[model samples]
Target chain A: MLGEVEVEVYAEVKPTESEVKVKRAVLNIIELDELEVIDVNGVKYIHGKARGLSYLSRIRDLIRRERIRDTARDLLNHSVVGDEVVINVNKQAAYVGVLSFAMGEVESPLGPITIRIKSSNPQQLIMWLTSG
Target chain B: MLGEVEVEVYAEVKPTESEVKVKRAVLNIIELDELEVIDVNGVKYIHGKARGLSYLSRIRDLIRRERIRDTARDLLNHSVVGDEVVINVNKQAAYVGVLSFAMGEVESPLGPITIRIKSSNPQQLIMWLTSG
Candidate 1:
């Protein structure tokens, strides 16, 4: 896919050994407002409500209102806060387990950006992302 | 003063003619919980409540609550958000005026970080910082 994204995966608990060791893996940000979700291609999915962007937006409103100074915006510019996302960790040889937590870090030239995901099945998320 | 800080100043609107030119000027971050504030010396002061740290703290709570993914933590790590700060732009040959809004940008090795201050006395701030 032209806009398909790749994500680096981590487990709920630190992994003793490398579960899935590969380069970049296919990643997806999906919304799961409903309780129903489909798991395919060993691609594990995680669900959670997003609050980062909301916080940022609140700050933006404050700026517009002149309620407070915008200090953080100075450091993180041209960056966006993502809403609820479903991580479709498409990695081969991944595992299938419940995921309680999941997160990833992106390394940019300026710095590294870490994305933390809270899920009921973090283990499964790690397995899916690590396998392929 | 032990904890006194220095700030680089800018004008409310772009200044074609450097109103107050100086390398670095003494700065103060005072809390104006009360409406009353005193002006002293050529140092002009700007007032506004702080919201940057509050926003970050909200995100931290989200992390604890598992409401959203922690993506920004990877970048701009170990930074802090300040509460309400009063900028006492201390410089010689300063002017006095009402500040509509005042914001500042800090340059860091990772990138250029801009801290925006909303003040009712921006022109005064610029004048105060530039004079000395």
Candidate 2:
């Protein structure tokens, strides 16, 4: 009789470091990269990393399009609003803005500084803002 | 000659479900559990999962204590300001909030709702706010 041989197969991956440090807060984004478009089942979006601190990980991806339409139906006439948020950029001081909407940007300084609606870094922002 | 034997190893681990639906934002925190305290290397901090959409993976860990002291010395008397930001929670409507400081909590609804300094949910906050 022949002896059976066993082997382990490992997937090819480098465990991307999607992390960032805005001011003093650290964020981590697992399995992300610069401009990597991804789709989870039927959802589509992109991945990104936080810079600066090595403890913060975050992600920015587009929601499933179907969900948008569903939300519209479930809450028709629902007027979307914005949240008051503040940001500080590389010693440039902090500026106040409103996160009216969201757009997944695989880049940092996320979308040319000032945006009309929505923003990233809320968890990070609140963490920093609340931490005395 | 003596025969040799080998054994396989396994661990007690299940992929964590750290996701959120901030408007339409998505974030993933690998290997995280609600209110699970963690310590990697010499760093110690808490872990949290986002609420909203799934596609964003962001982290909010306090920088090493020594780093904070270093930054203070590096930029003495540097006035820390705020960034113009916005937010919308449930049906409470949108309200602009500045993430001036950060305090990690293993719980969501992140604190009593409103805060003074620091906040969480940037990548998520941004993803939803921008996805028009």
Candidate 3:
């Protein structure tokens, strides 16, 4: 019942098939810690080990406002990498490739993560929401 | 715990200092359809809403195989991009970016998933693991 949430009700629109493929790749290629995505009554979630409002909530807001998903698909299709590139793709999937404003050199992972979720898996989603 | 699963434990050696930044950037930048990451004793995971053990599991195996996190940080640090190039930095971080074996693209909030975790958020991780 994501819709039932009394909050402002912020949710990004669903993504397309191709976009899914690219994101899956990004996670595969990079991300160290794996996050869990659980959906209940339509509300999706990324399980984390930290406290506070989870860092991703901040990222998600930016994604929705900037429409980064669609932009990513465009970059994927055309293969564009620049400081500020405006990707033009069909069907406006809404995405953004943020130029990290942070600093410091990062190393790699101690080992790969055990699990990763990039989209909604029907069975797991059902299990996650219903089990709880 | 994850080690016992046996399957090559393809887990990336684990991420360090700054690379998490760039990879997190990539996630915020262009991916759609949120993924879940569940860590059991330390195996991070990304949960998908699809079937067949989830698509992101494929991505994780890749993350470990390649050292994209180190590369992402270097990119985030020096901001480099090309058809093919080298990402040299302080230490040896493992990461690789596959241009894309398929066409089209994407990852996001169905309605801004109620739960989103980027790193080890702590409590939730405990809840997730203990509950299971």
lDDT (CA) per prediction: 0.24, 0.22, 0.26
Model 3 chain A lowest lDDT segment of ten: A4-13
lDDT tens per residue, model 1, A1-132: 112222222222111112121111111122223222224454323222342222223223323343223332232221223421233221221222111112222112111112344334444333323322
Model 2 misplaced stretches (Cα beyond 4 Å): A1-68, A73-76, A80-132, B1-132
Q: How many backbone clashes does candidate 2 have?
A: 117
| TM-score for candidate 3 | 0.16
**Alpha carbon lDDT at A127, candidate 3:** 28
Decreasing DockQ order of the candidates? 3, 1, 2
lDDT of 1 at B105: 27
- Candidate with the greatest DockQ versus the true structure: 3
Q: Interface Cα RMSD for candidate 2?
A: 15.6
- Candidate 1 vs candidate 3, lDDT winner: 3
The clash numbers for all candidates, in the given order, read 29, 117, 82
* lDDT accuracy of residue A112 in candidate 3: 15
Query: What digit string (tens of lDDT, one per residue) describes model 2 on residues B1-132?
Result: 111211111111101111122111111211222433345563322334333232122211211222343342222212212321221111111111211121122211221122111124333333332232
Q: Please list the residue runs of candidate 1 whose C-alpha ends up more than 4 Å from where it truly belongs after superposition.
A: A1-114, B1-110, B113-132
Model 3 lDDT tens row, A61-125: 44344555455333333322231111212111112333121111121111111222221222332
**Could you give candidate 1's per-residue lDDT for residues B48-71 as a string of tens digits?**
234222222322332334422223
Candidate 1 vs candidate 2, lDDT winner: 1
B18-112 per-residue lDDT for model 3 (tens digits): 22332332233224244445465763333323222122243334333454444333332332122111222111111123311111111111111
